[model samples]
Target: MTTTISYEQAKAYYEQWGVNVDLALKQLNQIPISIHCWQGDDISGFETIKSELSGGIDVTGNYPGKARNGDELRSDLEKALSLIPGKHRVNLHAIYAETNGQFVDRDEILPEHFAKWVDWAKQNGLGLDFNPTLFSHEKANDGLTLSHPDEHIRQFWIDHCIASRKIGEYFGKELGTPCLTNIWIPDGYKDIPSDRLTPRVRLKESLDTIFEYKTDEKYNIDAVESKLFGLGSESYVVGSHEFYLSYAQQNNKLCLLDTGHFHPTETISNKISTMLLFNEKVALHVSRPVRWDSDHVVILDDELKEIALEIVRNNAIERVLIGLDFFDASINRIAAWIIGTRNMIKALLYALLIPHNYLKELQEQGNFTERLALIEEFKTYPFGAIWDHYCEISNVPIREKWLQEVQIYEKDILSKR
Candidate 1:
């Protein structure tokens, strides 16, 4: 049922086929994009950038919660929300305790803080990115050790899932928006090539529990956030196409693809095809890829970028949830967020310029050679323009304004740097 096409054929079709620029522009504007949050003390810079790009933020991983009570968290959420327009949405991460490469029990999580976060999320219109770290130490530490797979950890994961289910139920009863659970299994292989079969079985067991817990939910409940690993030269799990697709098919779960997670060996089009074969149950965490590092950089149009964008355009699946998974180690946290948001918006605009019908034909045929050829043709078209034309058309003015303000801020920060 999979189609194949050549790169050249894809290019010829794109060159010959006319694209509806206006329609593409409108669709691009409507796409929901978010920024990943690691630091959350002050989101002012993110807010400013959101205002400019007209996108939302996805608060993931660890975030600061120095606030004293639910009201304080709520107040912080409101301030963050106010930065973006009503059309944009925000998702918050469930806080977990980690120590020395292991997940501390739920009892270890500060009760008052936990309750505050739950209540704050309910009071505000934010969604939750429920993590499954209680089940494994990968997110907390780094690698997946198969020989010493934590069986004791399974119970903790079950407890966390049940607790999250309760939170979701509470949200449904109180706020009418279903609490969302996102599972990103950081569990994978390290050195010595551990028993892959055992971890795979455990991964299934954990997912089954999660599915059972949320099966009766009336609203959106769970998304399997699939990741490919990159930590120096270390090997990680869920890094291959076969592994990801097989997991999704086996669990009957929607697949969430992180753009930067894939190794250099994988192809984006192949990933998209897998998602499409599974009824378009795919949500994307879109970011740029850097070799040997999941830098989560801003995506822009180059040859490879065009191919990636083409896959999405041709697929045309509406369930896609776009978010940026980025990190800001330098400068004030706010500025990092702003820069990240601006870059994402620019990437979206670039994607909009792709010739959809041409891509669709190539995808339908599943021809890699034709696909590469078309990509080359696309490269040479109009002086080898990829995303630049769309960027010029859509983001130039906003970027100019951002530059004017950011330059001054950059100078001040650089003086400190």
Candidate 2:
């Protein structure tokens, strides 16, 4: 009837596999997943000057309780964090800058615009991450930025990314944790491109100029994200995974792999070990893809478990930076955040409880049959019991109980919006 008693019983089962359940829970508590802020408002940031959601991405459903402003967004995020059993980071985009309703273009925006966010982060005891908004702007209306043929347009995005790095540095300095400022551009062609090399060259040059104005690594870390294709850019995307992978390796930067950005057949879980072998660190945007890069809410699917297993087995827990990236306006926004984030944490916990060493040894000894059988058997292990104990100990609601709190919040706080 009690969680402690159930957890003790579960511990014994894992102990038979030479697994340390207590250590697994301790490691799970120490790991922090970065929760994306865009989910709170359906990627509709509070920018004074707005543009249509373009650049090969779109958010559907008119969910009525979307946070309309910075304060409301943070309030909703606070509610979500209260339910998730960990101290996590918040991922922000440049378009979320607050300038008191003043029209501040992307390139001209400064660190001061995000001072409120930094202060709020400090108050909440959370780390912050950032992204440069390269789509949905006049400069990118032609679906080109950082790789545009026009010198003026290309330079504008370069300036914006440079400013974004400075803001990231400010956050890292103020918060005592390095801020990951990731760059994801939407420069591609809907159809076949007459010239692919030229655009990639321009993108490389623009990035060179942006990285030239560098900040201290202690305060800021830079990463580049690549995509297979997007809505408008069906046939060609300039920053393919190969392009950014090579760039990150040569430039000494982190490569951010978005789970949904790769082809349907491609799996980020398989890529993690290879990435860790080459790069000092790797970053992730954990999202689910329905058909294409749909950015669906993450679930405890097989791929999620594989991704977590890769990280834990390789002892790359500190080397991999995990962040959630999904936006669904069909349901309560806060509930979306809670579900996606909690699932991510659950995947990590599940991985932590596995006996990876024994599995590897079995493979090394050419015992494939045993490896497969043991892995499958472990799937039926009482993972839920350990997780419920974690939630109970973390002072968060257990299992579906959090849903009741979300419903109450929706009725009292979200419905009025």
Candidate 3:
């Protein structure tokens, strides 16, 4: 079978279904996805005296050309940002600091460490977000950080987090957009622990101290991320989803939901509405988890679609933030970034094209059969044509053409690395 639809034809078809193609494109253009910087370097950022990646974090393949340092990582990121549509933001971990052989520890980090990144983002018209690097440090070897049993260890992490917040605020002020500072500590016990409450209590106290100094909300926002479990922390994790969700609500902070930090059968779509309802705004770390929380490259899959649908249906685009959090070193790093990011945008656009009001009316009036039919019928719509048009207007390659660019990049650039 061979078929093709012209722009006029596709636009007319979408209009018939009460979907305004123009509106969809405009909405998608306004939404900026925060691409994780660690992907360029296989989660190995530019920190001196690096520690083993503890917690549930590990990158499998030793793909030939991984970014060894800051320069290579930035160069590859430039290639990636060029291909993706919309004005995007870059998410940076604390480990990616561009120190000029200063050799500062995490607890001693300051806004000066990321001065170049802030300048670069300003020149490129990009927003920036930050995370405190709580794993892969000598102190984190025991699979504990802020929630560590020792007070000195916990306070060290607390000071680091406090420094991270100041740095995030600096990025926000210098770039003229709010910088989201997220705290995700890999503190948990690999085996069954007799005392869980004490650790959590200590964690709460440590967080309280970190948040004691606040930056202007207009410039910076604070968030806490929770994980179900990780590599070493298999038996117990201190910061679970329930803990962070509750803490965020009570303390007036944003709750960051990582898609990979959930049970196999649990879909983040189910939690979106609740987060939107309770918090003033919510942040999301969208990634594909195959079987368990094995951070795989994202695709236009079922859970991703449902997640996009929930946001669009609730009209929570402005109230929610979308960020990518996955690293696959098994393939071309830049391609992995583009594929996952474009799919994130693609899923959102798909959700925007859905006629939600009409469908909701159908379900409310006892027309289950009609509603189900409409749902299935929507799957066959001219979504690809609309998507291609978006790519065209955004000046990016459409269909399979983008992959060819990646291949060329590999031959000329990534292959050399």
Query: Higher TM-score: candidate 1 or 3?
Result: 3
Query: In candidate 2, how many Å is residue 145 off?
Result: 0.4
lDDT of each: 0.47, 0.95, 0.88
Which ranges of candidate 3 are over 4 A from the true structure? Answer: 1-5
- Which sequence of candidate numbers ranks them by lDDT, best first? 2, 3, 1
Clashes of 2: 0
Total backbone collisions for each predicted model: 23, 0, 3
lDDT of 1 at 305: 53
Relative to the unseen true structure, what is the C-alpha lDDT of residue 99 in candidate 3, on a scale of 0 to 100?
84
TM-score of each: 0.64, 0.99, 0.97
Cα lDDT over the full model 1: 0.47
Q: Residue-wise lDDT of candidate 1 within 278-320, one digit each (tens)?
A: 6455666665565643444454545335434644565553555
Clashing pairs in 3: 55-231, 56-230, 56-231
